[model samples]
Target: MTLDDKKRVLREMVLHRRFEERCYQAYIERKIGGFLHLYPGQEACCNGVMEAARPGHDYVITGYRDHVHAIKCGTDPKVVMAELYGKETGCSKGRGGSMHVFDVAHRFMGGYALVGGPFPLAAGIAKGIQLKGGDEISICFLGDAANNQGVFHETLNMAKVWNLPVLFVCENNQYGIGTAIHRSTAVLDQYKRTCAYDIESAQCDGQDIDTVYEHAKTAVDFVRSGKGPYFLELMTYRYRGHSMSDSRGYRSREEEDEWKQRDPINILRDKLIAAGELSMADFTAIEKATDDYIENEVMKFAEESPEPNVADLEKYVLA
Candidate 1:
């Protein structure tokens, strides 16, 4: 990667990390509500891939654990905080909460909370693009546990049969809720699941931004060229628990520390420093700027936003 690209990734990853840490603080202060999922250690998965995607053309849809995706897709951080606070000024007008951050303008489809739900939705979106004769693509991100769901299989089957323009990205963080992938699945080769539908698949070290971008770019290009769907298994790990409520009883501090040593953001920063592409001063400046951005956004979301009125409770109801 060029020095410029490396710097860009560093900035985005740092911003993502700080933004998530601030969210945790907001939850503690009771400034935000709902299931607060932190994307602390998985920044590279979202940052690098979003960089590779052709923004404004390709669509991104994903299951929960989506705050990173929202930020990476260019949604104003303040609005996202407002959404978590259930304020009227939020991106979903204070209705969607933490699990359903949708930004139509940026082509970020609904951040569905249902396990494996976005897989088919992504395929359907790609089908729409194909039917309309547009060269757009959809990238569906899901957890490793989601790969076992029926929707995953069904979506892959349909996508392969129809030759839809979509990329199935499985961010295998090794565990789903409290169950690790090794315990949950007989075969741990998550990428091989795509072969059942005869789709192209590749696995990459999700902790490395450059590796992810290189592989995802190739997979995305294949789908964009009308060659049908492709799949990428990003072997990543999350530092935080499955949700804010986790008691940390399921895993040990030692295991967590081991993964922390391989932290993606720190790894990328070290690489830049070792290559003499960035200095400690530059990184410190970036960190301060990102910290200020998150803090300012939190205050902005809290001060200027209003909660939803009671009358609207049954207003958007479809029945």
Candidate 2:
């Protein structure tokens, strides 16, 4: 990536961090109701991967920690905030708050609320692409805990068997809600689990945007080349609890502090500064601009947008 490209990604990562921080404040103030998950430390995982893949062109789906991913995939940030606020102008028309943000026009399929639910759905999308002879690949982002589900194995096996172009990204944040992964999952290394299905896999430091982008670029290229499925496990952490309601009492403060020291945003910023590509003043300016955009634009739109009409409550129901 060029220096300018790195700078752009740095700016984007800053925006994502500030956006999620604002969401946390909104949730606390009761403006955003229901199961809000903030992606503070995991900014690089979404930004880096999206940078490697064509966001608006390729198919993207993930679990409920999805606001940042949707934005990276070209969904309007204002509409995402509106969705969290349950406004009629939301991406899902305010019907799918927090968890089910969807914008098919941009090909950001949807964020599933059920754990492991997106596994097979991603495969199905890839199968459709194969049948249609399309070059687009389906990307599924899920947490470490979701890997334990039956669908995880089933999806990988089927993806390889049919040579489906799908990339399964595991954001292994080390904890599933309140339980550390080791307590719930037998194999600690998430990438190694793909060995059962004979699919190629790798793991990397999720806090470093450069590292993620490099590895993700290779994985994306491999999958898009019609080589079947690839699994990438990113070792990262979430600064907040699993959801707005989670107290996060299961984890220790020392562990959280240690992870915070290697924060993704800071890693990229420091790297640029050391390389003489960016100055502290430039970073401060980027922060201010992002803050203004989120507050003046994103928050304002969500706050002023109209709530869903009472009579139209059944609008998008499939039944």
Candidate 3:
């Protein structure tokens, strides 16, 4: 990556890391309720792909672990934090909580609750775009565990048959909750499993933001070229547990330490420093600023934002 590209990636990675750190702190402090999923280690997969695409045109949808995706897609941290706080100022008016954050302005479809809920929705969105002869494409992001969903196969077949402009991004973070991938998936190679539908697929290192960006860009472009749907699998690991309540006894400390040694943010920070593209002082200052932004702005915004009124309880709720 060029110096400018590295800078962009670093900035986003820092924001994601800091934001997630603060979110975890708030959750522990009892300021934010409901299930909270942090995106600390999976920053590269979300930020790298969003960097290579136009959020104004393309639609981005993902599963429950979506705060990072929303922030990267242009949703302010304030509203996002407010959502976690169950305040009306949230993206979904505090109704969606941690999972469902929908903002049409930035084209972030939502943080769907179900593992495989967004597959058909992504295809439907792509179909709508195609009918209008629009150039924009749709991105469907999910976890490795979601690939095992029946809807995943059905959606892939339909997308291919209809030649929809969609890119399915699977962030394989080794294990889903406590179950290892091998225990759940018969086809261990998530990318090649798409060959059954004759869709083009590839895999990349999720730790290297630039590599993920390049591969994701190509896949996004391929889908945008009016071709059928494409699938891109990213091999990554989450340093933290799957959720706030996960006991995490299923993995070993040595395994977690092994992945930590290859941390994406650390890898980029080291590379940028060695290439003379970033100084240690600037790195410290940048991270400090990100911390300040989340601590001061995001926290205060969520704190001051009013909770949803009981009288309006039925306002956003669907029948």
Candidate 4:
């Protein structure tokens, strides 16, 4: 990546971090309601991978920890914040809230509420691309725990059999909603599990944006080359609990502190600073700009946007 790309990624990660922090405050203040899942420590996983692919051109889907991914895939931050606020101007038109941010115009399929739900959905999208003879590939971002679902196995099998153009990215954050992954999963290494499906797979450090981007680029290329599916396991750790309601009692303070030392945002920022490619003043300016944008633009849009009208309650309903 060029110096400019690195600087752009650093600013994006910082903005995502601050945005989620504000969401935490709003959730606590009862201003935003729902099963809020904040993405703080895993910014690199999404940004790096999406940076490797064409954001608005490629199809992107993931589980509920999705605001950052949507923003990276061309969804405006203001609309994302408005979605959390359940405002009419939200990306999902105020219906989906934090869990289901859908922006098809950007080819960001959605952030599904169901665990492992995106597995088949991604495959289906890839199949459509295959039939249409388009060069687009579907990217699915999921957690370590979602791999346990039967759909995980089923989707991989179908993707391989049909030679679907899809990239399965597992954000292994070490735990699943208070349950440690080791306690629930039989196969510890998620990348190894892909071998059974005969799909190309790799694992890498999710804390480093550069590393994630490098490996993700290779994986994305392989998938786009029409060589079937590729699986990437990013060994990451989330700083917050599974959701706002989680107390994180199952995790230790020592573990938390250890992971914080390798925070994704800090990793890239320090690398840039160490290389003299970025200065403290430059970083400070970036922080200030992001803070002001969120405050004066995103938050303001969400806070002032109108709630979904009662008359349109059945507007988007399928039934």
Candidate 5:
């Protein structure tokens, strides 16, 4: 990667890391309400693939670990933060909160609450594009647990049969709410599950951006080149618990530390430095700038944004 490319990737990853850290702090401080999930460790997984996506053409739908997707897809952090704060300026008009950030303009579809709910929605969008004769594609993100949902299998069959252009990405972070994939999932190798339908598939280290980006180029190129659909299982680990409430006692500290040692952000940081593409001073500036951007720009915007009016509580609702 060129210096600019490396910087761009790190910037996006840093934005996610900083933004999520602040969001978690906000949640704990009672500044933001509802269940909060942090996307700290899964940065490279979303950043890598999104780098290959075209915002106006391609689309994305994902489960609740969605803040990174929305951010990477060009959603304004200000509005996204506002959404989490339940303010009117929020992307979902203060209704979607942390789990449901949707912005139609950017083609980042709903941040669905259900585990496997987004699978069909992604397929439907891909089908719509195909029917319209538009050459666009949709990507779906899910945790390993979501693979157990029936909708996953159903979408796989439908997508493969109809040749829908959708990429199913399983962000397997090892644990699904404290249950290890081995204990919960019968087919531990999730990508191989797609063999039944003959859809193209792959698995990669989610913590390595280069690995993911390289794999995404091939997978995305295949799907974009009119291959039915693709499935990729990202072997990753989430440093934080499933939610803010999780005590995380189900896993050992040694295990968490092991994964943490391979933190995606640091991996890229060291790579760029060793390649002579980045300097320590440049990285320090990035760190300061990231903190400043979130504190002064996003956090301030969400903090100062107006809350939704009680009178409008019945407005966006459909009875």
Candidate 6:
């Protein structure tokens, strides 16, 4: 990444980290409701991929833990918060909540909740692009656990057989719900699993923003070249529980702390600061700006976006 790009990625990673931090704080304060999943540790997977692709042209669909992707995809933070609050001005008009943020403008299909649901949906999106003679690419983001499902192999077989333009991103965060990857899979090389379909694949240090961008760029380009789907297994970890009410008895605090040491935001921040790309004052200013922006959005959503009139219920529903 260039110096300018590095600075931008650092700012983006911080925004995601802080945005998620604030979301968790809101959940604690009861200002935000519902099952809020924080993306504090997986910032690179969302932000790095966003930085690599054109938001309007490329499509990205993922499982729940979606707020970071919404932010990265240009959805207003206030609307996301409003959705969590079940307010009308939300991205899904207060219906989808935290799990289904769909933004057509950015080509973010949705935040599906079913473990491996988005796999085939993303394939369909890529097929649509191919039919329309467009160069757009679709990316399906799923956890390592989803890789075990029959849908994963089915999607891979069909996509490669048809030469669909898509990227299957496996965020092998080392855990799925509560089970470790090693305990779940006999074959731990998640990238090598792509060989079953003869697709190109690579593994990256998902904790490093630059490494992610570079590797994703290569994989995405390969897929876009009509070479078929590319798979990337990003070795990452989540700093928070799976959801709002997770007991978290499955992992150790020491494990979380060790991953925190390798936090993508911190790594990018340190690099930018050490390389004279950014200063502490600049970093602080960026943080303050992002916080203020989010606060302003929240207030705007609260004050300006009206609630859905009860009389209008069933209006959009099919008979």
lDDT of each: 0.85, 0.94, 0.89, 0.95, 0.89, 0.83
Tell me the spans in candidate 5 whose CA falls farther than 4 Å from its real position.
Answer: none
Off by over 4 Å in 1: none
lDDT of 4 by residue, 85-202 (tens): 9999999999999999999999999999889999999999999999999999999999999999999999999999999999999999999899999999998999999999999999
User: Model 6, poorest ten-residue lDDT window?
Assistant: 294-303
The parts of candidate 3 lying over 4 Å away from their true place are none
lDDT for model 1, please. Answer: 0.85
Regions of candidate 6 where Cα sits further than 4 Å from its true position = 299-304
1-319: candidate 3 lDDT, tens digit per residue = 5689788779878988888888889889998788888787888898778777786579999998998888888899889989998999998899899988878899999998888899999999999999999889999989999888899999999999999999999999988778999998898889999999999999999988888989998998899888789999999998788889987899999998898888899889998999988899999999998888887898898999898889997885576
CA RMSD per model (angstroms): 1.5, 0.9, 1.2, 0.9, 1.1, 1.6
Candidate number of the best lDDT: 4
For model 1, where is the 10-residue window of minimal lDDT? 294-303
Put down candidate 6 lDDT per residue, 1-319, tens digits, no spaces. 6788788778777777777887788789887777887787888887776677777678989999887787777877777777777677888887788888878787778899988989999999999989998988999888888988889899999999999999988888888888888999978989998898998899988999888898888987898888888898888999888888887899899999999999888788888888887888998999998888767766456546777778877676776
In candidate 5, what are the lDDT values of residues 1-319, reduced to their tens digit? 4668878889878888989999988998898888887899999888888776675468899988888899888899999999999999999999899999998889899788888999999999999989988878999988899989898899999999899999888899988888888999989999999999888899999998999888988888888888889998899999999999999989899999999999999999999999898888998899899999999999999999999999887886686
Cα lDDT for residue 279, model 2? Answer: 92
Tens-place lDDT digits, model 1, residues 171-203: 988888888788889779899888888999999
Query: What's the TM-score of each model vs. the native?
Result: 0.96, 0.98, 0.97, 0.99, 0.98, 0.95
Candidate 5 or 4, higher TM-score: 4
Stretches of model 4 off by over 4 angstroms after superposition: none
